[model samples]
Every structure is written in C-alpha cells, then in structure tokens.
Target chain A: MTMTRIEVSKTYKLFINGAFPRTESGRSWPITGKAGDTFAHLCLASRKDLRDAIEAARAAQPKWQAATAYNRGQILYRMAEMMEGKRDELAQAISAVPNGPLAPARTKSAKRPASRTSSLRLSVSPSLSPAAEVSAAIDRLVYYAGWCDKYAQVLGCHNPVAGPYYNFTVPEATGVVAAVAPDQLPLLGLISLLAPALVPGNSTVVIASNTNPVPAAVLGEVFATSDLPAGVVNILTGKRDELLPHLAPHRDIDAIFAAGLSASEAQMLREGVAENLKRVQIHDVAAIAAGEQGQSLEHIRGGVEFKTIWHPALA
Target chain B: MTWRSPTVDTVMVGERAASFTKRSIKNATKRELLTLALSMLDLTTLEGKDSPEKVRGLCHKAMRPFERDEQMLGVRLPSCGAVCVYPSLVPTCVEALGTSRKVNIASVATGFPSGQYPLEIRLQDVRDAVNAGADEIDMVISRGQFLAGKFDEVAEEIRAVKRACQREDGSYAHLKVILETGELETLDNVRLASDIAIQAMDDVTPSGTGDGNIDFIKTSTGKVQPAATMAVTLVMLESIRDWYLKTGKLVGMKPAGGIRSAKQAVHYLVMVHEVMGPLHAGPGGSNPWLTPHYFRFGASTLCNDILRQLVRLKTGKYVAGYDFSEA
Candidate 1:
C-alpha cells in the first residue's frame, strides 16, 4: 500500500527493509556536490536506520525467495529496459565517462585490462561539470546493466557435488547488502551497487556518497518510478561510522560493504560479517585505480544465500 | 611569545595576520598547522593518535604526577581525552591509568607508515586492536597503489576497515583512516583524499571516496619526517568544513606526527580553534573520544617542556630542566 508523506524541513528517511523513517540519532547534514553547484540536505542515519534496515531485510526475504529465480532475472532485465528508455531524461543516472586529455591514452590502453591494482586517486578538477560526471555515471551503470545476464554465466562456475543433488551453482546475488558509497561519485558508484544486486534478485541499502548524495536521492526517485519492487533497494545518506554498525551483523543482513575504508575500517566489516558468516569484500584502491575489476568483485563476495536441496529415488 | 628557531619556519603568518587571527594560535608555524586554528573556514576535529607503546608510557609518566595533589607541573589542561598507543599495550594503559578518569586508547593498524600487507592481515590487525581494548583505531592506506591512481582499490580497502569494528556500541572501536598527505602529492590529490575520507567517514560513495571515514582525517604517520603538516591541515580543515556546512553533519579532524612540544600542541589547538571554531568539538577529555578528544599531538617528548614552563610560572624564577625519568 502506498503511504502518506510526512511533513518535515527536509527528507532523509531511513531506507530500512524498504520504508523511510527518520534516524533515531536525529542528525542531518548538508551535502555539496555536482561541481559545487548544488546542495542536497541529507540525514545522517542514526541507530534507527540500522534497525530499520534489519526489519526491512526480514520483511523482504520471503518474497525475494518465493519469486522464481528466472522471474528475478527477468525483473533485472526489465530494469535495464527501463533504464534504456529513460536514458535521455535520466542523463544524470546513466552519465557517460568523460573524454578528456587522458582519453587518448585510455583509448589506446583500453586494449590492456589486466594491469591494474589498489590505491587512492586524488585528482581535483574545478572544470568537472555536474552534467559531465553524471553522464559518465549513466554510461557506467548501463554497462553494468548489460552485464547482468551475462556476468554470472561468465564469472560463476558449475559446482560438482559428490551426490546426485542436481547441484550447479550460478553466481547468486548477495542479499540485503548495506553499502557506503564514495564521497565524489554519488550517482555513479551508488548506482553501481543498486543495479548489480537488484538485477540478481537481492535488495540493497546504500549510504549515499556524502558529497554527491543529491543524485543518489534523485536516483531513488527513478527507482520508485521504475516499477522496482518495494524492498528491492533502500538508501540512507548518513554518517558511515554511525549507521554502519547498526547494519553490520544485523540478524537480517547477509553481508556488509564499505567504500574507501582504512585498515581499521576494513577490519570492522570483516569482524562484523564474521559474526553471522556474512561475506565481506574490501576494495583495494591500487587495484581499483588500475581498474582491472571494479566493485563487481565485492558484489560477488558481499554475501549470497544458496539453497541446497535433496531427493530420494525409492519410488 | 616570539618562539622561533634557526632550523624551521614555524609561523609564516606574522603580527599583521596574527592580529586578524588570535593569540591562542601563536607558535603555530612549526608545520604551518595554526591555519586550522584561526578560522571557521573548515570542519575540523581534534585528533590524538597513539601507536608505539612508548608514547602512551610517556603520557602516563607525565600525567600521573600532576593528578596527585602534591608538588608537580602547573599545567591546567587535563591529559588528552584518549591516550593513543599501540593495540598491544591498551590493556596495560587502561589498567595503569585506572578507571577513575576515562582516557581512551587509540591503536594504529594496516601496516601503518607504509601500507604494505595482505588484506587478510590488515583486517586481522584491526580486530586484534579491538580485542586488546583499543577504544579507537588508526590505519594507513596503501600509498603505492594510490600514487599509481588506483581509486577503486583505495575505496574498497577503506570500506572494509570500517566494517570490521562491530560491537554493541555499533563501533567495536572508533576508526580513523590516515591519508598521509605528504605522499598524496598535490593540493588536488589532498582535496580528493579529503573528499574520499569525508564520504567514507559518513559512509557515502563519494566522488573521491573516503568521505570522513575511519573517524579522523589524519595528516601522516610520524615515521614520515615532515609528518602530518599544516599544509595538509589547511586542506583537510577546508574540506571537512566545506562538507559540514553543506551537510550540517559535523566531522572530526586530527593532524599527527612531527609534534614535539606543548607549545606545538597549543598551536594545533589554536589552529583548530580558528578554523572550525569551538562548535567543532565537544568538551576535551570529558568526551569519550580519548586524548586529543578534539585535538591531539602525537608526541614522544612534550612532557619535559610542559613541566619546565609550569615550574617557571609557579616559582616566579627560572628553573633548570630536571630529568623527569628519575623524578
């Protein structure tokens, strides 16, 4: 059922299980992104958002599981279709990567994809326009969407069980993942998490990129408009250290994802995910900066639920 | 207080700018850190990180004598909210300091000073620090890949570290990721790192990654000669404040390394005061963040001078420096 919108100075609803609630910590912040041209008032997810995420995970599990796996695949394909239709209007959602001075070098180097690793890339460009970044992001997301049907087949391997269990493991989506997006690529990176998981039948909760949360929030409008399921995605654009623990080791969550974490930060997730055997994938900046594999690795390891069935032939 | 020396150009901002600035920020030129203390141009938080066990030991030797009501140094500020030390020594420090005053312990992880280690080992170290009772944790990123422009790997590593600190408090330990500004190589890189840290701090997918993660925007590890300096401090403060004003969520700041004297510590305080303003941090030691609750100097020898100055003021006569160890 559709719910009535609550009155407030700004909207930073806790994107829990699949609904929006104010953070119990009752904190908020202003986000300045988009070439320093806009401000998107955001709410720091308090303990409440974490709780809400857990509750949402619990509520959505049965439906997600009950949906036929084939049907789930179809929905993702549908999302891609919708994205294609709205690419013109949702230019920011599917922003294309820029073709700058480095473009020539990258164009030439595009032939070699294996030489990359983890490290930080700190480049500031006052010239980077909001429109340009968003365009690049849209292109990036569209690329991931195309990979939805193909990646699992290409990346996942067939499992050979000892018994006649009919066991062949297709790469499954990590369920109800909680992710913290990078500060700069608000639209692009957050979309990276959403499309990958939703395409695979898993829902996700994202802490919007602090600086560029405006576009992520804008993307939420797109999600709501796209016939996306109620619990398919939730976003809490708030403080990482504060909101994450609530989501970490949450009885309902199966995995945890953080962007640009330190050793200490990486350790926290490793430990939190260990409690429930939730898969934890930490990004290696050097490898990523080198760009051999983006967040898709984390998407695979973030956490997936597998069903093992048995049969007897006594009939 | 015309405190200067032949080896360094501590305070570049002179009397003219000082008039516009404030006296609380004097002697800030050492690393050019005072810029953080002079204005509300950035969102800054005080940072005190303790790694080598030796540093925490020094804090105790210096702090205990003054706690008892007998004859001691006349310094007034309480020990920093948290005494940062290596994870291995947290239990010892916590017990030694006693539970009377809440002094938190901060530990460094992920092959600090040089980010060279397997991802598994890095997380293991942080977990070990939390197990050892570290109230806060500091970590360094892999500079090698970063310098090579591996943004994704950098973003992912920071994200993983934050995930490891899970406890009933939601944070097994407060996490602070160090960017080591000296290595980032440029104002643009520093700004980008700041952007990443701030986002990571807030748990967002930032343009640059690291939003405000790990807790503090630390400048550098002491091992790097110049350490966490003022240029980075200015840049970090500017980034944090820029995010804060736009978001309304307060982020913290910490400039570590190359800090050797109380006067230098005071300059950092002055810089923090000037940049983010008093609203930036809560009560010093009263808050649970630990030594340098809002601001900290990662020093190994600040005790002696603090004592000498206090004695000089209280006795009304110049006193010779004494061996604090034997005392």
Candidate 2:
C-alpha cells in the first residue's frame, strides 16, 4: 500500500541584522486564509526585536553611508534583479490573501499617470492585480536604483552668497529610519516605503503589513541574497498598532516613514517626535501604490539632512 | 601536598552548561539579574598601548558606569567591582579612582597573558603591584610547566605569588590565579589546573585567619582564543564547589576574557548559583562566592551592553551604543 505524504510548512521569522531569527518573546501569530484555514505562522515581534534591529542598523549605517552613491545604486539594482527571479513566488504569496488583488471579477483599471493630487485619497482605490503589483514593486525598486547616485545632484544646489566665498548645499542620510508598510499591496507598499530612505543611505527597520505579511517575509529572502548589507533593511511581521508606540519614541531612530495609518495611529507617531525630535513622514496607502506619488525625489528628500558648506572662491 | 584531580565528563558538562542558558529570565527577574551582573564586572584595560590618560578614563567609568543612571532608572547603580590593568598603571588607577575607593584597583602582574618570566621576576612583579596600591593582583600560571607533569613547580610558583601579595599592613592583596585554560587543551586538564591553583592558594591562606582576603581561580587572561567557555567555567566552578565541600574554605572564581554580552554574564551567574547554592547559604548568612567579592567577570566591553539592557528595562525603549561613553 502507498502512503500519503505530509506537506511541509514554512515558518516566517523576522529579518533583523540581516539574519532570520524567531522573536525573543517566543510568541507567534497565525496567517489564516479566507475560509479561516491557517496557512503559515509569523513571529510576533516585540519591542526588544525593534531594539535589536535598531542596534544593527546603527552599526551598519556608517559603512553603508560611506559607500559611494554609485555603489549603493548598484546594490539597489541588485535587489530588483533578485526580486525578478522570485516573481512567481511573490505573486503567489500576495494572491493567497483573502479578497486580495488576485480575487476574480476585479476590473483592470487603465494605468493612471503618477501624480501627487490623485494619491491624496484615504480610501482603498482600485489596485493592480497580483502579477501587476509584483511587477510594479520590482519596477519601483529599479526606479529607486537609478536615483541613488542622481538624487543628490537634483536635490542639492550651489548657494548665492553675498561674499567672496563659494557655498553649496548637499543632502546627507538621516542615520537610522523606522518605517511602517500599508496593509494593502504588501510587496508594493513595502518597496515604496523602503526604497526612498534606502536610496539616500538611511538604514531602515520596517514593520511589515499586519494583515498580509507573507510577501514582506519572502522579500527578506530576496534581500539576504541581494548582497545588501545586513541590518541595512530589517523587516518585522506583527501587529502595527503594537509596534507603533515603541517605534515612535525610539531615541535611536533618526526618522520615521509610515504609510496607511489611521488618525490615532498617526497621532501616536507624531507624539513621539517630542522625545527625540525625530522626523515623522506619514502618507496614505493609495498614494504610495500610485507610482508617481510614491516614487519621487521629494520622498527621498524627506529622510535626509541638508548640509551647507563654504569654501574660498579663489582657485 | 599531593592532589588527586578527578576526570571530567565533557559531554555531561557541556549539556549541563547549555541547560543554564535556557532558563527563561524575564520581567523583574531579568532586571534584577542585569543589575547584579553589572555590579560583578571587573572593568579591564590590559593593552600594550594603554596610557595613563586611558587608565584614568577607565577608572572614571568604573566608578560611575552610566552618567544618568539615577535620572533614567530612578536607582543609583553600584560601581563596578574593580578595574584590572597592568602593574605600571596601578598608580594611575589609584590617582584617578581617588580616596573614595568605591571601585577597587586590580593589576595583572607576573607577566600576564603569558607567564614566561623567571620565578623571581614574576614574584617581584606581584610585590610591586601590591605596594603600588592595587587592592588585588591577577597572576598567570606557566602552562608549560603544568602540561609537562611538573605540577609541584606550578603550585610552588602560585604559592610564591600569593606570598608576595602580602603588605606591611598585615592585610594581603587578594590573589587571582589565571589558569589560561585555552592552552590546557582538555576539560580534564582545565579541572586539574583549577584544583592545583585553588589548593596552592589554600595552603598559604594561614589557617584560622578568617580575616584573610579571598583568593580566586580565574579561567583566562583575555589574550587567547576560546578564553572562557561555559563548559570550562563549569568545570572550574565544580572544582571550587568540591574544595568548599572538603575544606569549608571559600575560593573565588573569575572567568576573564571573551565574555562580552549581558546574556552570557547572567549564564555564568546561574552556574555559580546552582553549583554553589544560593547567595546566603554559606556559614555567615551569605555566600561570598556568589557576591562580587568572590565572583568577577574580567570583561571590559560588557559594561555598556549591561547598561543598555538596564536602560531598556527602565524606559521600555532600546538605546544605542553611541549614547554611552566609549570608555
């Protein structure tokens, strides 16, 4: 008689300091499908996990920032290349969610031009299908990859001084950055939140989408193989509300970029600015998914510190 | 005096040591453990490039540890147990530490890291450090002599070093014998070295002088690979326990080097508590071995990590290494 084989299941762990580790709290929550069938388990990251990630980010930030801008661009492009190789698996994880982008009967809307005004809506506007979202996420990475070396040139400018001195302003990375991804379009939202801060050389610790974190966890695998330095980008999968309070008041986190937060959640993040005077940038999920608004020079500029220097005008 | 050192079960010792790390230390218990571990630190700087200014800075850090301890944790932290340095820097530590003496000054003498010098020079090294105002003297054993079956010579050298720790005031500077177990090659050798060192110190301790300071059997000199492993430390702790059981005398244990994390320090404390019993189980209502007086960690990088953990426990937020002083 032939025996039936047991299906092997995968455990989704947090990506911290470039390695996958179970939460120190040893707690886990389930990711259930539409019919309430549990498919996988993800670590319920605690405040300590956030703390550990920040330590790693702080340690890696200097060397990463010191790397030439062209080199950072190459690494970012590598991320996109790795993502393309895993496109099928990423699409599967995204479509596995209940009523996700791949649900039948979803109308395929005509592509909208990237704009800041249309992205201002708070509601969940019609999003692309799973395949399109995955492709868009990959493209978004490539988009930032090109900006890594050029963002400084476009954002910086020579100053007009009233003296015989040459002066100019350049943007510098704002140290470690903490981010929150949107619940809708998990992969696309994460890439949108990550690429801008990362392109500018700011190390990031991002809380993945609470409702659909499978894609973000899988993206960690891509990051590990992309030659991206460990701690450059750490991903945590747990309840956003539970992590926001800890993320906001963190003194080590130089800035915060969050998308798709409610009024109270946004308030929680803003209130923490008083503790460390960290920069807080909040955006809508729909806006982040709208490529034009999400991928822009201004987004990269938000997480940087502008430094002005003066030198003798004489040769 | 002849000694019979029992053989160690390497697998059993490793398994037992691994089990201590699995203890779920959390909440108030974790906070208490972190603070206790902080108090047991022997902030050390034994470098060839060590300067007077550097030793002074280390002494300052040893006394205060964190500048804003009371402001952040609402509890003033106890100063570190001692500051270990080269004998030449003993006077520098003395001046920087001032007369408050909250942090004792410990000096590594007898050709530390490697004890290759002649017996007379090594003993003189201990005397000079003790006279230079060091409250403790850390000496290294000649691994070559012990490994070559010359146990008697090794024991005689340790006894000579202990004698040199004596001062004009009749009180002796505490002696810590570094086994340099990394060179011992096996758990059995580590056990034998620990036993020989403890017995030699006990022999010269002057019986009925409960007033004599406690001596230590340390694991390494922070200069070798695999300086202090859990298994090696457990074997030494068991040796100390066996000595205590047979003679009713307390011998301190110091595991120097390679202990850089707060978690690892706590594991060492757990082994001490389990193998030797609770802190107050001894004859005088307290086990000095469990206290900083009998136990110490010769680790310099571990202080900031412990301070960071303590701050996290207090503020519910994680802090960065840059926030603390580099000393």
Candidate 3:
C-alpha cells in the first residue's frame, strides 16, 4: 500500500479538444522513455488538432446520438471499471517489452536496473492489459453493446407488409468516423480504433500514433474524464501523413478508418479515398497485430435505416 | 550462282552477324516451343516453407511495385534475381531489392539440385553466402559424379564452390554451375556442362575459385523442371559466344528455370537476340553490369505477376486478389 513514483511527464502539452494546448504547429518534439524519464518538449498536433477534432466531432454529434442504448451500455460497462482502477499507470504506459515484467516489482527490479532501460517494463501481464487493453476494448464494445438489442434480429431482412404497414432491417449510424491509430499499441491501438466508431453511435476523428503522441494525449485525458457524450471519441495526436489527407478527403467524413497501409500503402488508401465514394476500410495493420480487434466492427455501417414510423390511420 | 544479291542494307547487313546459321539455331518455332512451354505459367516454385518471414514476405511482394487483390494469386514475375534464401535471408535479399535493380542473391550449395553435400557442407553453403550477403553461388554438379561419368568429380566440386567464394573482402560471388539440366541429358551433355561452366570463368589460379567465379552458366536449379532451356540457352549462348571469340573475354549467360513472365521476359529477350547477334543480346547492348549477369527469371510467381502488373497500372483499381491473407 505504498504508491509514490511521480515525475508524471514534465509539463508535456498536446491534448487538443479536452485542452492541453501549445502545439498549433510550433513544433516541440522528444518523449524518449525506457525510463531515462524523458518527455522533453512534446507538442506538435496542430491545424488545431484537426479543428479541435472536427469541432469535437461536430459537438458530440447529438449527444452521442441521445445516449441511451441502455445508457450506452452503462457508459461502456463503466469503461471496464475505469480500466480496473489504473493497472499500474496503464502498464507503465505501454512497455516495449523485455524482462522487466512478470512483476514482483518488475521481477525484483529486473535483477537490479541492469542497463539499457529494459524496454521500460510495460508488460502488465495478468494476461496483458492497459486496462486489459481497455478492458478487452470495452468488452469489445459491450459485445457491440449486446448487438444494440439483437443485431436487427439476425442481421436484417423482413418487409412485405405493403398494405397494413411495417418495414424492417435497421442498424444505422455510418457517419462521421475518421480513424488512423495503429502505431503499435499506443493506448491499445487507439482503443481498437475508438471502440468501433464510438460504440456504434458513430462520431469519431482519431488520428493518434505519430510514434505514440504522448500516449494519445493520455487518451484525450481518458475521454475527457468519461460520460463521453462530448465528441464521442475524437483523439487527434499528430501526423498520419499529416492527418490522413484531412480524414481521407473529408466532406464531413462519412467513413475511413485506414489502419496500417502497404500494398503500396493500401493503394494510397484507395487513392486517398476518391473524394466522396469515401467509405474505405483497409485496416489490416497486421490484422490489428493479430487479434483483429473485432475487425473494425463489421465495418460499422449502421448507416442504413427506413424507420417510417407514422401513425395516422383515421385513429 | 551467287548467294550475292546479299541484301541492300549492305545485302541484309553483309551476309551474317555471326552464329545465325544452323538455319538460325533451328529458329525455335513449335510456336516457339509453345511459348517456351508457357513459361510454365510464369513459374513460382518457392519450396519456401518455414518462413524467412514467409520468404521475405515473398520478397517484398516480389520486389516491390505492388498490388494483387484476387486472393494474392501472386504472379509478380520480374524479380529474376536474389531469392536463393536461407542464410537467415541475406538481409532479406538485401532489404528486398531495388538499388538500381540488381537482385541476384542465390546461395545454393553442393547439396542443392542433389549434388549431396559434404565438401565441408559445400564449403558451408559457400561460406554462408559470403557471410550473409550473397550475390550468387548455386552449386550442384555431383549428380553422383555427373551420373557416374565423374568429369573429374564434377570439376572438383566446381573447384570447391569456387573456393568458398573468395573473401578478404574483394567479395567475389557469381559462381552458379547447376548443370542438372535434368541430369545433363545430352545437347551432348549440354555442351559438356557448358564447357565446364565456361572453363570455370577463365581461371586466374591459386587453384582459382574467386575472381567472381564463373559469372554465368546456370542452366537449372528450379530443382529440375526441365532444368533451363532454349536448348540450354542455345548451348549456353554458344559457350558464351565461343568464349567471346576465343577469349576476348565476355562470359555471362544464365537461362534459369522455366523462365517466367512479362512474356517470359520478352521470350528470353527473343532468345538472346536469336542466339548471340545484336552484340550477343545479353540484357541488350554489350553489358550493363550484365543484367544480374545475363538474365535470370528463377520465378516465385514471376515476381508476383510483375508486381501485380505494376499495381493494375498504378491503382486504376481492379483488385481481384492473390494471397496476402492467410486469414
């Protein structure tokens, strides 16, 4: 019961929408780590963190689509009990790997600080976690938050009520996502790309991982201290070949996640997403480093609905 | 009765250019040996299992310049060099090719194409590809003593893998002597194993093995699929144009395995300009470091279908697929 080690990053700077400032392109670099305790200078995520992550994803897109899918699956199962009460400062902030783990205080101070910063001891292995990789990425968005009440009952199709009236197949919301992440587990691959487009209610902007942008601006200060209805997961950080051609040709970005690139950078992210035929996915950053984090939630396209719920049949 | 109306462009450029008359090396036609036996659908024999990073990710999707959508049906065949792998992948084939596209890393030794090793494990696979940086060594001549005829124990195990490719950092490599043209089945033993591999690249003794040993004579090592042809590269480009007209020096000529694509690299550059003429068409025009020592297309999906036909003409997007997802 003796928690003490703090030099928690010497006045770093770059968070963006949840505010840390000082980068609006005035540069400032270094973060070093393997614990020679570096973090020097830091900044660099401007064009105003892509206009404050697209105006905090257009001012938290209608209160993250009016919150309730059972209170957004209890705020994503209370972000897995706030990532199991900070599993050792998220495994000493992403440990690159070496013996400094299997913790008995990193295997007894890894046989006494034996040189070259033992890849700064990050193996939070009780079977790996940074909050169990954001609690298996929000128990994988509460198993797609229990398929937003049964994935439109066995994935859509049922409509021939012609005269009486009652159509079907509904799981919409394929709008505004933008993602880039995958710079090697920088905040669990940017929470497996902002939890499948903010747990299906959409609104995202994520650029993150220009070699770990200060642990993704400390996950935008843990989604601006949770109840995330503001900008449903905007992220930002720095340089995805300079913010993926403004979110792969953004016309208010309908879809783009991109992920790793190569097969000629995924054919230039399918020709920088030929304007608005935009919805590109590509993703395979080695299949999200082989766990395929629910492969970008079946390419999240809840963008298909026909809810014509009108009741005026002569009372 | 003169055969003297002999051209008009200097009577068809003065009678002959040189060696264009066994009625022109029987002018190839059986529809050019069925387009050289359909260059065996652009041959891609990898034998590459147990990953050298899946053979350097099939050598960076067969020497970069990529695309291949259809389940990676991989035919990128332009990478006609390097890819003899295993020497912990000689810096994954010198970091997967492209520095003015040279590419020939070969390393096979006596054990290859069954010469059955133990000349100090074929001089430790040619001194482990000249200490992991091979540019060619491909041994193999003890087809159990050239099928028991023992041409002096296959020219002293190609002079001890060309004396374990002579190091002391003058770094000589090109040795290649795999005449398993399916066990030398006569073009009179493939012109005496192409004259003892062009007399071991014109010896410069100390029991000579490296002055870049035998820069070219490789006929087969795709472990014998009709071990390299065009009648063994027209009897090894007529023993390298009769050892460059009796030793004026020009020595390369590599006819490797079922020569795969870009129309079998223009049907072996039209059979090296129809057998030794337009300056013995060696990678065309005398020699540009002699195109990895005179042409080689030992395929692995013809360098992934010439990098998926230069990425379907630089991303005009026609993705069909050819393997890069072992799902």
Q: State the DockQ, from 0 to 1, for candidate 2.
A: 0.60
Candidate 2 chain B weakest ten by summed lDDT: B278-287
TM-score of chain B of 1: 0.72
lDDT, candidate 3, A165-225, per-residue tens: 4555555566567777755556655666666566556777777665556656555555566
Model 2 chain A poorest ten-residue lDDT run: A102-111
What DockQ does each listed candidate score?
0.00, 0.60, 0.01
Expressed as tens digits, the lDDT of each residue in B1-327 for candidate 3 is 111111123232223322232232222242332323222221232455635566556555444323443334334333334556545566666766645544456766656667675788777867876777776776767766665766666666676677677776765677767677767655656666667656654552332332444466777777676766555566666666766666656666666666544345445555565555555433335532224444455555454334433343444332222322220
What lDDT tens digits, residue by residue, belong to model 2 across residues A1-315?
Answer: 988999877878999989999999999988886667886788999878887888899989998899899999999999999999999989988888753332112122423344732443455573778899999999999999999999999999999999989999999999999889877788898899899999889999999987789999999999999989999999988788688988877778999998776556666777778777889998877777776776898889988999999988985
Global lDDT of each candidate: 0.54, 0.86, 0.55
Error of 1 at A127 (Å): 81
**Best-fitting candidate, scored by DockQ:** 2
Interface RMSD of 1: 27.5
**What TM-score describes the B chain of model 3?**
0.31
lDDT of 1 at B20: 31
True contact recovery of candidate 1:
0.00
Model 2 stretches astray by more than 4 angstroms = A1-9, A34-39, A99-126, A156-170, A307-315, B278-284
